[model samples]
Target: MTATGSATLHIDAPRQRVRAVLLDALSLPSWNPAFVSLAGPAVVALGTAYRITVRPGLKGTLAYEAMDLDMVRMAWQVPGFAETGDWRLVASGDRTLVHHDFTHAGPIAAVLRQAYEGVAELRLGRLAQVLHS
Candidate 1:
C-alpha cells in the first residue's frame, strides 16, 4: 500500500447488478485493465486464491478478501507488487455509485503511479460501456 489511485463511476443500474459485475472474475477482462485471463474458480470465494494473467505473459495471484452488499475487496499480488482493490458501492434510486480504489506496495506500484489515473479511466470507461450494453 505505498501508492494509490481511485475513480468513481455512476452506472445506471442497481447496486445488486453492479455488485454482480464486480465479482465476476471470469468476465473481468471485458472491463478490467491489464487483465488478460483468469485461471481458477469461475465464482470467487473469500480466501480462494486464483491465478491471473495481467498480460499475455505477466502473471499474478488474487483472492477475495472481503465482500458484502456495499463493497467487495480483493487482495492481489504480482511479482514485486501487492495491492488491495476495493469497489465501494453506493445506491441511489436505480443507480449505483461505484468508487473504485486501490492501494499497492512495491516497485511495480511505484512505477504505475504516473499512469494510474489514465489506467483507472480506461478501466472505468470500459466498465461503463459493458454496464450500458
Candidate 2:
C-alpha cells in the first residue's frame, strides 16, 4: 500500500445495516460534511462511474471521477489520486467492524493521505452514529 491508514469503529447495529448505510451514495452529502454533492446512478455496482466534489477546507472543491462498488467488499479508484485498498466489513457479535484501507498514488500522495485520514475518521464516526441511531 502507498499511503495506508485504517480505523475501526464498533457500530451498535448488524453488519447488513451498517453496509446499507455505507452503500447509500445519495445520502453522503447529507451526512458527510466534506462531500458537497454526488452525481451518478443511485446503485453503485462494479465499474459504475461517479463524480464527487470534495471540499478540502476553503481551498475550493476538488472534483474526482471514479468507479466504485461493494462486492462484499469496497473498492474504488480515482486514477491519479488514489485507490481505496479495501473496505472490509466484519461481524463481531451484535456489533459491526468497519475496516478501510487506502493507497495514495502519484506525487502529492502524502498530503492527500493526511487530509483524507482526517476526513475519513469524521465520516466513519458519523456512519457509526447513523447506524446506532
Candidate 3:
C-alpha cells in the first residue's frame, strides 16, 4: 500500500441493493468494463479466493472479506502488482453512497496510482449506472 486514492459515488438505490450488486462478483462484467470475468462462489465469503480477468487478458486473484455493513476489505495480487482496498456502503435516505479506498505499492506504483486516479471517476460512474439500473 504505497499509494492511496478514494472515490465516492451516490446511487439512486437502496443500500442493500447496492451492496448486493457489489458483492456479486459473477455479475461484475455486466457493469464493469474492466472486468472480463470472475470465478467464485455465488456469494462472496471471507477467505473465499476468486479469480478475475480484466481487460487485455490481465488476471488477478482476490480474497476479500466483509468488514461491516457489507463493506469489502480485499487484497489482490496481479502478475507484477499487489493492492488492497476497502469498499463501503452507507444509506443516504432512500439512496446509497458508495465509498472506495485503495492503496497499492509496487515497482510501478506511481504509474498505476496515477492511472487509477485518472479513471476512478469514470469507473464510479459506470458503477452508479449499474447500481441504479
lDDT of 1 by residue, 1-133 (tens): 3877788988898899888888888888667757787778887899998888785467888899888999999887888778788888999999988888888898877877776765555666777787889
RMSD (Å) per prediction: 1.6, 4.8, 2.1
- Alpha carbon RMSD to native, model 1: 1.6
State each candidate's clash count: 0, 0, 0
Write the number of the candidate with greater TM-score, choosing between 1 and 2. 1
Tens-digit lDDT track of model 3 for 1-133:
3777788888888888877776777887797676788788987788788898866687988777664675867777767677777878889999888888878877656566667774556656877888656
lDDT of 3: 0.75
lDDT of 2 by residue, 40-106 (tens): 7777665555676655422222222332332233343343454554446778778777765555665
**Ranking of all predicted structures according to TM-score, beginning with the best and ending with the worst:** 1, 3, 2
Error of 2 at 46 (Å): 1.3
Clashes in predicted model 1: 0
Ranked by lDDT from best down, the candidates are 1, 3, 2
TM-score-wise, the better of 1 and 3 is 1
Per-model TM values vs. the true structure: 0.90, 0.70, 0.84
Instruction: Please identify which of the two predictions, 1 or 3, would achieve the higher lDDT against the true structure.
Output: 1
Best by lDDT: 1
lDDT score of residue 128 within candidate 2 = 81
